[model samples]
Target: MAAAATSTSTTQLSAPYRRSSTLQNSNYNKNNNSNKVPSNGVNGDRQVMVSKRGCNGVDNGGGFCWKASFMYWTLEDVAHVARHHWILCLFAVGLLFFMAVEYTLRMVPASSPPFDLGFVATRCLHRLLESWPELNTLLAALNTVFVGMQTTYIVWAWLIEGRPRATISALFMFTCRGILGYSTQLPLPQGFLGSGADFPVGNVSFFLFFSGHVAGSVIASLDMRRMQRWEMAWLFDVLNVFQAIRLLGTRGHYTIDLAVGFGAGYLFDSLAGKYEESKRRTSLLLHKEASLT
Candidate 1:
């Protein structure tokens, strides 16, 4: 009975110590859990925070941190876009302004004098030419000489230099020009200065939709550039500009015609290049097949 009592007392005394240890262990586990960052919660939500030094030495979380406020994020994105595409932004503003201008623009009356900015700018020159028919003829003669030069360069590139690209481009451009020109024949402009020495001499009928003169010059200039003849190319470009101005002053071609001529020259050159490349690829394929056989 004494031993049984002693054992019972020992059990009662150890029970409080065990309970205190259990409580301490539970508190420690709770503290550890509270200190730990949650990778995932019961609802599968994950939250993370990382500190990193920013450009200004302040903690910015990280380089691509998403913890920033909405307004700040939006402003950062806007600044990034603006820095890279400022020109695009400028054009966008221009687009809006032009839209407003177009909306407010008045329609021109049919009876109103044909208003052309180029014509107005060259009014004095035009008057001088009108007064001196001989001077106009002389200018036409000089322009013809320039045309001859362009023709010589193009032909020489094909026949002498063994480069057919310019020739092919010229042929393609002229053929397309002929088709387009005949399809819609614009009436001759008023106050046109005719010259006996001009191409299609004696005021013969010609297409007015696009200027072949400008197109031909562009073709020659492009070929010169390809040949690395910088001096010749520059000369062609300057003469081409003068030719365009003279054409405009003489009422030889409309503004749209000259612009389209420039485009056509570039377009035809590209097409010709593509054609040559295709031909070369075909030849290579045929040779390879023959060798394999």
Candidate 2:
């Protein structure tokens, strides 16, 4: 009887230890379950990350891409979408109409120059306001900043297999046009387009120089859209500031053209964004926003 009682006491002592071990194992299994869940499972976090990263993939319905195996956009996609780029098309159409109207109102006498009342007024504004040393210095500094940033982007593109040829082309032509327009001043020529000192930023008439810049800038921006987010973010802001100043300040261009061109050039950049939908992004996308503000 004493031996039986001893056996019962031993059993009671071991039972609590067995329960404790089972509880410990259950807690371990709960902790492990979260880590081991499949990404496709209902409550997993990895699936969300994958979906977010999948933006702009080809065959993702409306999404875009630029590669074959990697889901990059085809040339056709860029062409079609770019053709209908809503904002650019709208802005271009508006500028075309405005230029056409300006053309009708302008007076190009054969004996003298081709400038009209509009050119006269714009020129007067530049002479009166932009001739100041301080304003000139500020604008010149701004122009240099724009030019330098553009160069940096192009160099980066050359080294990194990025799309910036058009942007660089735009910058080159922009610089060239500036020089040519400035040199042709003083005894401005007869053709409405070829000669004029009145245009503040460029003396080479309003329609041609402004139109070319707007057009070239658009093309470059279109090409740049193919770059990764970080690439675009790096340079867009610096470019925008110069562009705005060119449009708004009272030198070189018609205020109208400058205003219109800003939208057009900006539209070019926007088109690139749509075209390169499949490129990888970085946190630097915020630069697009920050630059404008």
Candidate 3:
């Protein structure tokens, strides 16, 4: 009986010690977990991404990054850009000068290269006219197409006069101008297309009209009427640049052709606006001069 009681006591004592060991294990686990928690809270995400997502620079440079915002430019490039468009306006002035001096240089025969696309086209057109039996009808048709005032009227009435007139006008005007621009050819020397006709009324020159559209579009973008006077001067230079870009394309026109085309467009546009003002000024000046005399 005594041995049985002793055994019971031993079992009770061992149960308490086992419980104490379990409690110590739990405390150890909690303490370890608390130590594992990062104070910064960013280590996990930083280790995975921060190293890879480095800013574009050497480590020593403190991530000083820059991008190329400026396009390439040079003095030669600037000069070329300037010259590229200036040729067009200058060409127009030169043409006018040449025309004015025609009487003085009447005796001197104008010379040009024998073969060119302009001449080729002119010759083809000439042959087609001379051989074709029903040529008069074609001539009349061509004339109607070439006539600027008639086209402008049609454009105004059918294209411009209706709903949202600005939209239609802008579209139709550009198209008409571009199309008519390639049709016209200069009346120069002989080779393929000999001197049968010079600036023939029946033939159309489209190059000129194209300038009108190009220059007109540019003018629309730079509506200087509301802007300052100095800003208005830039409009001319801007239009000239557009002309140069057109010429650089090089598929449609020769140097001279581009020059002339741009000049014509610019001049036509300028005159469209300033002609009345110019006349008024001229009249005023004439009256003032007369009074002074």
Candidate 4:
């Protein structure tokens, strides 16, 4: 009878433990199923449906959809740009003002003579030129001397300084100038001063759209600055200004010609630098391949 009683007690205790174990297994299976995404064909079908919807949305909206995706500019973006590019914002305002001015400005009559502010400002120099015609010749001779200095410096940069960028830039600038100058020839300015000592001596026909003298000097000056030859750079800049004044005073070049010359010099120098960089990169890639082989 005691054996029977102990057996009944043991069975009763094990019954609750078995029930708890079964409940835990059921909970675990539910959690595992909830965590897992189904890998059946239905999931893939749903993904394809979503993708089709997106394509349809874009097709229906046309450019608007693309703009919405790419150009979602917000106030934060404007604030960020304003903080970083305040200078550009100021320039934008200036550009708008100038555009308005240009739109409102009156056009000069086709029969009217070409007018240049520099020419107007140098009225005294014009008077001097008229008073002593030989003064024009003297200034031309001085300008020739400055040209000689520019040539010497450019050549020296290649031969002595072992830097050929200035020479390369000059070559590019002159070639472009010749092409442009011949393509569109501008009429020579009136009240002109000619001299036998001037460049392209003996009054030879030359391109007047852009001044090689100014461009050459600018190229040399830029190279001087790159070399940290500050004094030489400053001297060249000063001489260039004087040369421009002389060109203006004597009507050797129109104001547009001188301005374009400065721009061309800077442009060609940048081109030369790019050319050197490309060459260096090519040589490096070749060396790397050769070593690997």
Candidate 5:
């Protein structure tokens, strides 16, 4: 009975020891868990996101940190933070220039001396007018497609790429060409398209110095090529040639006008490319400086 009582007393003493050890072990585990960092995926997300995210002004030496808040911003918000005001300004200026050119076109005298080359080409092409119905339909279709492509390029460059130089260059060239077209005050050819169906805007007698269609096509083609849209570029290039021929056949533009238009398009495209390159370099330099400091 004495041995049995001693064994019970030992068992009671060991139970307290076990409880104390269990408490110590739980405390140790809590400390270990507290020291350990969470492995949730925020670090990986940071590596994938743009450094500009959550940046209010230019980044001033803060290493890339992805913020969920910045990632959720809309395109307009991003563009605003990027300071894309020049795009809006260029568009506004282009609109003003268009209005000015249209006014000049309206004011120019209807009777102007026609270039001999244009006269000769128009006379010859006019003789081939076998079917007005077919010719008109074809011309209308081409015009519609050309206008659509030009509009798409303008929107893509400005809205998607946040670049307005292409649109600006096109607008500036178009205005300048229009001024030149009206300055000559070229006389309308005898077989000139007169009806509203033939000339969507008005008489083709005024803006005949260079084929706007050809110039626009060349600009759109070059811009498309620059944008890395190879198929679109080639399509516009083909359309350019086709439009040139159509202008000649319809007596809408003289040969000299077409030649000048082609040259102008190339020249302006080069200018726009240079402008865009400079802007890109500047942006890169600024971004680098911002990152370093």
Candidate 6:
């Protein structure tokens, strides 16, 4: 009797473990099954299913299915994702664009001198506003603030929000501005006179046709808009207008320059928004399909 009771207890203990092993195998099989689909799975069914192994390996789908939360994507997550192929490509493009812009600024002179509307507008604005010393000081202060805000926003977008689009947009604007700047090679307005501090680089005798400040402002503004920060968008828009006026008032740029800058920046912003939205939608669809499967 004693031996039989002992044997029964051992079997009872082993029974639970046996059941546990079977449950684990069942789960494993289910996961494996998810990677397979019925013959009609690929047909035009209203509902679709996705498999993790199939999506990540069997197909050439990119690694963008991972869910992202704005509050959770810390700098570390950004660094991790920055190593992705697409991000790497963006970085390469941004670097090349930056170098091109810098080279253009340093080497190219305007192919033709400024004439017509740009020169006339600059001449008039300089004559009217160049004499106001206090106004110049205030404009300088505003420009400084604008630069500070733009830099901060870029850092936040790229690092905190994990947005590579911001970097690309900035590089694009710089390249466009540089190309225009070198192409126009227009001289400063005839009455262009301001505090000597305005041209710290001492090349104030010329360099016109497009305003980098206004372009930078516009890019920053549009980036803020994409982030869905209405307050920031409004603030940057107002600052951009002020920056454009400052460029004209200080004889730093012509009206045409501001207009071109605005156009180019706005165009880039639209393109970036579309690209980002498409990527987001693709990722969500894949995730949902995978979950359903």
lDDT of 1 by residue, 1-293 (tens): 99998556443312323334445447745764687755575322222222121121122333333322222334444664466668877999999999998999887687665556777777888999999999899999999999999899999999998999999999999999999999987767777888888876787889987889999999999988988999999999999999999988898888878999999889998999999999999999999999999
- In order, candidate lDDTs are 0.78, 0.48, 0.43, 0.80, 0.65, 0.63
Positional deviation of 59 in candidate 6, in angstroms? 45
Question: What is the Cα-based lDDT of residue 138 in candidate 5?
Answer: 58
Q: What is the C-alpha RMSD of each candidate to the true structure, in Å?
A: 21.1, 22.9, 28.4, 19.4, 26.1, 22.0
**56-141 in candidate 2: lDDT tens per residue?**
22223333322232133355444544455657667888999999988887566767744434455445444644456465556555
lDDT for each residue of candidate 3 in 221-288, tens digit (9 for 90 to 100): 33333244345446545644533342233222344544544454445445444654677799999999
Pairs of residues at least 3 apart in sequence or in different chains that clash in candidate 1: none
Q: What does candidate 4 score on TM?
A: 0.70
What alpha-carbon RMSD in Å does predicted model 1 have with respect to the real structure? 21.1
Worst 10 residues of 6 by lDDT: 44-53
Worst 10 residues of 3 by lDDT: 191-200
Q: How many angstroms is residue 118 displaced in model 2 relative to the true structure, after the best TM-score fit?
A: 6.9
User: Residues 1-293, candidate 5, lDDT per residue (tens digit)?
Assistant: 99988555443312323334445447745764676534456643432232224322222344353223443445544454345455666788899999998888645344655444554655655565434646655575666677677778876887898878668778778888878877776656555543344434444345777766677778877777777889988888877777676667666667888899899888887887788799889999999999999
User: Which ranking of candidates, highest lDDT first?
Assistant: 4, 1, 5, 6, 2, 3
* Model 4: per-residue Cα lDDT over 114-164, one tens digit each: 878888987788778767878888888998999999999999999998999
Off by over 4 Å in 3: 1-100, 103-169, 182-209, 221-224, 227-236, 242-293
